[model samples]
Target chain A: MEKLLDIKNLHAKVGDKEILKGLNLSVNPGEVHVIMGPNGAGKSTLANVIFSHPEYQKTKGSIVFKGQDITNKKTNEIAKLGIFMSFQQPEEIAGISVFNFIKTAKNKLSGAPVDFFELKDEIAENMNALSMQENMQNRDLNVGFSGGEKKKNEILQMLELKPTLAILDETDSGLDVDAIKTVSNGINMFLNSDRALIIITHSTKILEKLDNYFVHVLVDGKIVHTGDKSLADEIDKHGYSTFKGK
Target chain B: MAKTQLEELNRNIYDFKNPDDYSFKAKGGLSREIVEDISRRKNEPKWMLDIRLKALETYNKLSLPTWGPDLSELNMDEISTYVQPKTEMKDKWEDVPSEIKNTFDKLGIPEAEKQYLAGVGAQYDSEVVYHSIKADLLKKGVIYTDMESAVREYPDLVREYFTKCVPLFEHKFIALHYAVWSGGSFVYVPSGVELDQPLQSYFRLNSPESGQFEHTLIIVDKGAKLHFIEGCSAPKYNKVNLHAGCVELFVKEGAYLRYSTIENWSKNMLNLNTKKAIIEKNGKVDWVSGSFGSKISMLYPMSILKGENAKTEYTGISFAGANQNLDTGFKVVHAAKNTSSVVNSRSISKNGGIATYRALVKILPEATNSKCSVSCDGLMLDSLSKSDTIPVNDVQTSDAEFSHEAKVGKISEKAIFYLMSRGLSEDDAKAMIVRGFASPVSKELPLEYAVEMNRLINLELEGAIG
Candidate 1:
């Protein structure tokens, strides 16, 4: 089968500093790929460049998703092409209710009129599954939310949007063990035969419950090693120092 | 992704102009002759004439204000203070001349009156062209009519309250307003009477290089309740125009009043309007204001709590676009024990526009245990735009509780990027953020007016995105 996303020697930079140099990755359907790297290994840059963040410049190479070259596409255009990124730090947009935000996003992606009550119920059920307060739907988006709640909100969007490829960037870094289990449960619920996910993290707490996944060791903007599941446990037992300067 | 094309929000609804036809147009200058001529045109009582003449003297004695926006561009020599339309005040809408009726028709005044208002007063230029109230309201002893008729038919009531809440000597523009004021609305809600519908007044300025100095006086008697809506707009012109209208409200003991205004003057116009209300024992006053137009605006509606346990609440917003400077806020004076006030204000500026929120809260020594809270936020769309907050808190007694919080910031790029990444166009992202910022004020307005304000915000944001 064709790859879901293919990146060839992707080189990107923000301002005058070069961040992602000579990076390459390929994601396939029904596969969970974990990219384990230390700080400054360009894990987050890889996630943002795929979404065409305005601040990041694609100096060289290309990014193709579903046979479409999205290297020069705008962020919203990329979003429309079934690509979603869960930000390491979500934005707090005051005065915009969470229900409205998700409804708008769903409409933009599907280009269909969503029934008000249907969408409201969908949001409420998702919040219940994530252990979020039902009143959160009426409050401003991510305003005054705890760190765990913010991460869970990102997961909620992933479930509602149902994109072909979803990138979770450090979603478990600041969450407690219970919140990590809830987030992991959310990810388990989103996995299906036609969907793919790229879990970018340094900790192994979120990957403990998942099965049948591939783990890649990313160091200095390059994936040095690829193995099945056990690679993640080795890194957790040890550290990224073994893979550094490779 | 391709940029989505959005149709420009039509401002032509307000930019349309009519031929400058009027029965009387005062000369472009200020003098005793012009003031006397206005009074004579209305055929006022000798006492009203004396008040106008005395106000003219006080106008000359006062100098221009030095603290706010510059007034050098304003030349009273270039402004015709009065322009009476070629029509008389008519009770029946059909009796109004076709041109004047067409103007109000375009503004949707008559339709709004039919759908939402209990009474309607439409003013064109310097005189009211049509005035009417429902028969049921009139049967309840509610007096709603033009200022000229109230001055002539109910002289004793008009004399007792006119210019009492806001003295002419308080500011230079107010003194000028008192001297040349012509067309306005007068509403007196009888004691213990409560109206389910609101009363609306629409002001349209059609003549070039002219001003509309209307006076609005409203009194809600003991245990009564009222909501008054004021709307103003004008067409654009090369020459500058001036608007210095005045409003005075009286809320009697245990009564309630809510005064809402949306001022959308042309960019070439300078709006310096004054509005004040006095709340008696156990009464409450609420002010809902939205300032969207005008080249420069310096308006600060005030509320004075005169009796124990009186309360006031103010919710206001202002949007300043290119070449516009909006200086607006609210003021409250706590004079009795246990009085309280709450103020929430928001401002948005883009493309070199300037928005300043200036406020004052004063508590007298006799007002013990009073409380006041103020919060203001400013959102600038671009780096070139500007926003400022200047708040003055004067407490004569330390026993009172007052708190003021202000925030000034540019629209966050990260927030914009985040929203866009969620599949929204950049323009939609910015507009959504702004509407969210202004929801606190919009939710307080009537549904129709809230929709209109949102459309105005969209129009202002059309060219804001590159």
Candidate 2:
């Protein structure tokens, strides 16, 4: 299998505090990687560091994506290389409509102008699948949106942009059962032979709908164990206490 | 990563110039003799001439403002009080001088008139060179013409409302404005007349070392409604230029007036403009303004709710980029019972620019049950830029409700990261955030004006981030 993402002994920090210490992971195309960790286990930090967020300083080690070193790359350059991360909490960007934001993102990723009508039709189709109102596209991005709606909007962006590697950081946290079902459906629609997904979540309720995934147990800034799909179930049943202090 | 080329955003698109071609030019300096020369050359009546002399005396007595941005660099003695264009005011576009018409063409004024406006007025240098109103509006008894013509034809109406809202003694620049004010628009919407389309006026100052102090007087009569759009631009010059224009609006009982202005003056221009509206019983006035270019600007459009249940709303945004200091805001005075006012102001400062929001809200004792809400949001693009909000609220009535909120900060690093992670470059992310910051004010403008304002914002954001 072709490796889509590889992190080798990644050490990162935000401000003065180091978060990710010698964390290593490898993601292959056509696979789902579940990252389950207790609080402060550097789960979200791994995602941010992979996307090269400016606030997260990669002090040591290297991150190679598709065999290219991107340790010092800017967030935008990394994003342009087909990596997308859904925030645990998306910022409210006033005055930018959801439709405009997605359209700009698609254009930037593809480096081509988008046909408005075609893009509109595609967004409408995906929004319908996500149970989002058509008027939601006209509203400011994530502003005044309910928590569930924000999560659904993130999934909608993922579906529209069709990035090769999608890092969903706690995307299922604030969602209701129905929203989770719809978001899972959207994620399944984005699944294909050429794409990879790294879903960082605490619960296995969302992972139950998918099949053939590798689950990694992260603790205190490093991954302690890796197993098949059963690992997620074991963690959900036993919690991270069994893996703590390892 | 390829670094985005930081192009110089200071290229002035309106920096085209014509040779010092003029039919008349007042001698450099501010004096009674120069004022008389301006008034006499226009063949003004005695009362108008006397008003000019009185204004000249007031201008001499008044000193530069002690607060706000410094005006010490502005030497009044070096500025020509007036400069009349070579062409006479023509109602027909074909009759306008080709050179002057070409300038308006370059600014897209003629095309905008054809597409959007019910009437169009083009002012070059210090005089309005062209003025025209649609036949339909004329048939509906709407009077739209130059201020000079209004003073000549409707002397009674002009005498009653001229300087009533913003008097010459209101400030030092207004005094200077009244002393040498030459050409502007005079609009009078008759009672119960609601025009379907907006009327527009475009001002272009082409002369160096000259001032364009055109007066705009608009009165929406009882139960009538009107929307007036004003645009101003000047070419860059080495010498200093001054624009101290005045706008006075009278919204009568049960009437509404929406006044919008986009001022993009040259960086060498000191834009000390004043505007005010007196709203009567149940009347409403909405002021939408965008200030983009100017070396130093101090503009605060005010509203006086003089009648019971009067209403006023002001939405404005200012962009001060590189070597610019813009002190802009809105003021409201609630003098009658049950009056209300809403103000939303935004400012963006980048590349060592300074932007300040200075606002005032006063609810008099008689204004029982009045309500006032003011919000000021400022965005600083870099550490070298500065943004300040100074709001004063004076409430004398216990029954009144007043609220003021202000926020000043730089773009969030997380927000930038979020946008960048969506495949946008850092520069693009910053520009998008800035545009979003100004969207509240721009969304209130007409579609064309909103697009123009966005374009101005984009141009100002170029090279804003390293």
Candidate 3:
């Protein structure tokens, strides 16, 4: 039984244009797969479809996570089923306290009352993990958070949910060097053999630890090339214009 | 099949109900007999009973509401004049039976009471079956109790404040409520009493298809402060349920009062409720309300500033999802020098729901150097849903300053694209935008309630867009 996510000919479109064209890939339990391509290349689309976003119409495709077909699952349901997606920009949920939002999210994933004392302790701990202020958990969900703070908050949610398959959508973008290292450690903390990670980012700076893993290059809505860890280094040195699937 | 052109709210609980249990009810009508029957049921003094008879005459002369949802369908003959839950008001929490206890329990009244509430009361059906207050508040001379007991025990106190501010002749609904009003809370803050915590009461209409005409009156005396929160709900009914209740608040000289309410009535209700507050010199009133349920509702809390340096702030949000027409807003009348009122409101209409915000601001000739500002924003998730804002500004004095601004718009497609470009699914992006649209109003609510408010917003927003 494959422990990783299997995407088979996943095709999706938004409005009139098709973004993800027949993309295909698979990741092992412990592998960290990075999808990189040009600006319009469907890197983020792949991340969204994997997390069962209601938009991004899935025309023809199948996404199997841990041997379960979740092609048409609700986002919250998909999240509870051990699939997590860290949005590139975390949403600012006004009026919703950070503690209450995370508590409900954790409950949805675990289907139980979050140990109040333990959850508070863990939230205090995870705030330090993301280099966040001690009172961040008490504040409204990203209401007045800065750009880098929003990304860190996304990573903070992912850490608490701790899904078996984590898909991070450019969460490292718009971060300073110090903040980038903090988010990078957060990814490492959630990395394990029993779980797989699908990180979609243009820069591989945060991918320093999990260097040698599967890399897929998406161009024109399709995974045109699949390679080892060095593929990311090649793409960084030479942009997507130098690569061709044929 | 085209979705049923769903209204903005599934407040069908305000619509229709099956009346299998009305207990002993009077045929809805304004007559001496009906009023006498009610007075007989409540066991009122002759003088008080005489007030009911006079109230009936006042009700007959008053005209029905000409604006908002049509109440012509509200047949007086069909409404059960009085329907009491078969229990008495219990001070000891456990003495309250399980069934009635379960209703308040579902509404999260006790939990909120323990957290930061100085007083709490739970009203089931047409009567208050349970009421309590923190001992420290009572010791501080803060009086919080059911209105029925207040009228009975403190007749002088009740006489001093009752109906004087919002008399029965104020309007038709007030007259109707005064005639048949059964259960609600009365909060009185004596001079110099500054309550630190909120006082709460949960109202539940459990008997199927019964009319609930409860009245809540709170008076903050001179140099005092208080915060009162009200919660209301009802079980679903197949017939048009009615809640023509009233609430009047009096914030006296240099006093302040904050009232918060979250009403989640079932979808079959015609929630034609009324509330008003009058502030004297140097007084302040803050209103925080969330109207998320009701089939057809026309509710607007009004504030009247009548003394120098008086101020008021009203923040409200209404969500109309399916089969609901919630026409709700607020009105502030400035009648004194340097009085101010600030109103911030938002409405979300989706799934064919209809949401409206209609308000009136009238500054009297003597209201010199007064200021008032109103900002209303509406977001319609789909083309079929509708949002409207009708505000009237009547400034009698040239020294009064007032501004009314509103915008009705649909969710931006570009914003959705921007969020999706940043990796959020279209649905998530839409939810985030809608959530943020309501942030101004929800942010004013307390902690746990804000989450519940967001959840209700999400529920109403799910199929609002493609």
Candidate 4:
């Protein structure tokens, strides 16, 4: 099977400080890849670099998505090319209702006219599965939302966008156990034989609920260890200290 | 996504101009002759002319405002204070000259009237070319007509409340307005009557290097309610144009009045408008305004709560694009116990434009137990743009409760990135954020006008990104 995303010796920096140094990873279709690292290990940097964040500079290497070189594509272009990232800290956009925001995004992604009623129904059902209030769709996007609710909102957007590759960056950090379960369930529903997910997380609790996943231990700006799901449990039991200077 | 080509402002709807064919155009300058010519041409009574002569004298004595946007470019000597269209006031839209009628037709004045308004008045240059009111409202003793007609038909009522709320001595531009003001709306709702629909007046300044001075006077009688809407626009001109219109509203005992205005003047225009309302016991007034054009603007609508339990609310927004300076805010004076006020204002500046919010809130010693809350926010689209908040809050009575909040900020890069990551282009993301920032004010407008305002914002955002 062809690789969904291939990153080779990716070296990136934000401002004057280099973050992602010589990082390589390959994600295949239908696989759940979990990246675990200590603080400053450049885990989140990898997620942002894929999107070509304006503040981050790609000093070296390349990122290929679905046989297309998107190393320097604009954020919106990358998004349209079927890449979605659930932000660690979701932005609170006032005045735009969640429903309208999702509809606009879906339309832009598909480049077609979306039926309003069908989109509304889809949002309602997804929000229901995530245990969100029925009126959440009417409220401003992420404005005044609780931490758990914001995380759920990100999941809701991921499920709605249905990208070819979805990256969840620290989405479970601030969530409670119940919220973590809901987010995991959302992830389980999103994964399919034709899709890929890269979950950059620190907790093994979420990994326990996810299946058919691999764990990669990142240290000092590089992924030094990669194994099956047992690797996540091993790292969770010990720590990133064992992977340091590897 | 429907690709929107970024270019200079798509202001063709408002920038198209007709030939300057008119029956009369007052020569550029401020003098007794021009002022008297305006009054005499309207066939006004002697008393009105005397008031005009007095106001012209006051205009000469009063100096230009020292604070706010510079007025050095506004040479009254080069501004024709009045331009009478080549037609008489017609009760029917078709009776108006084709050129002038086509202008209003292009503006959708007749269609808006047919769809929503209880009455409609169309002003071109300095004259009211068309005026009409629903027969139902006329039967209810609701007198809606142009200012000149009101001066002739209902002299007593017009004289009583003409300049009562906004006196000529209030400012230099107001004095200028009194000297040559023409073609505005006059609405008088009878006691205990409430109109379900709004009365609209659209002003179109078509002549170049001229001024538009329309006088809007509304008196909502005791226990009555009314909503008056004012719309103004002009085509682009090389020389400077002036808009110094005046609005005076009287919300009587137990009455309610809501005045809404959307002004989109040409970039070569100076908008120095004055609007005020006086609310009596148990009465209320609401001011909803949107300012999106003008080379420079200095407008601050005021409300005076004179009776117990009188209430007022002001919700306004201003957008200043390249080469525009919009100086606008709200003011309220609490004169009696239990009177209260609330203000919410927002502004956006881009491409080296400047937006300023200057406000005043005063609570007299007699105004015990009063409450006032004010919030103003400013957003700058580029670093070259500027926004400022200068507010004065004076509380004489210790029993009053007051709070004021002001915030000035630029578009958040994080927010923009978040939106762009959701599949929106940079321009689309910026435009969406701006529309969101302006949603609160737009939601306050009538539905059709809200759509129009959003379209205007989209047009303003084109070519906004460097």
Quick one: best DockQ, which candidate? 4
lDDT of 3 by residue, B1-466 (tens): 0011112334342323334443475665556787788778788778777667778889889898677777787777767767866668899778887766765665567777788777888887788888889888888878888988988888888888777777788778778788888889988899999988888888888765568888898989999998888888887877777888889899999999988888878877888788999999999999999998789889889999988999999999999987789899999999899999999999988888899999999999999999999999888888888999988889999888889899999877655643443334556557767776777777787766776676666666766665
Candidates ranked, most accurate by DockQ first = 4, 2, 1, 3
Q: For candidate 1, write residues A24-49 as lDDT tens digits.
A: 88989999999988888889989998
Q: What total of clashing residue pairs does each candidate reach? A: 0, 0, 34, 0
Tens digits of lDDT, candidate 2, B1-466: 0112122233555888878899888878988888888998889999999888888899889998999999999988899989989888999889999989988987889999999899999999899999999998999899999999999999999999987888888888898999899899999999999988999999999999999999999999999999999999999999889999999999999999999999999899999999999999999999999998999999999999999999999999999999999999999999999999999999999999999999999999999999999999999998999999988889998999988999999878888989999999998888788888899988999888887787788888887887
Per-residue CA lDDT of candidate 1, range B1-466, in tens? 1012123356687889999999989999999999999999899999999889889999999999989789899999999999999989998889999988888888788889889999999999999988999999999999999999999999999999999999989989999999999999999999999989999999999999999999999999999999999999999999999999999999999999999998989999999999999999999999999998899999999999999999999999999999999999999999999999999999999999999999999999999999999999999999999999999989999999999999999999999999988998898889879988998988899988887787778878887987
TM-score-wise, the better of 1 and 3 is: 1
* Docking quality band of candidate 3, CAPRI definitions: incorrect
Best by TM-score: 4
lDDT of 4 by residue, B166-210 (tens): 998988999999999999989999999999999999999999999
The DockQ score of candidate 1 comes to 0.58
Worst 10 residues of 3 chain B by lDDT: B1-10
Give per-residue lDDT, candidate 1, residue A147. Answer: 94
Off by over 4 Å in 4: B1-10
- Model 4 lDDT per residue over A30-144, tens place: 8989999999989988999999899999999999999999998999999999999999999999888998899888878998767888988998999888999989999999999
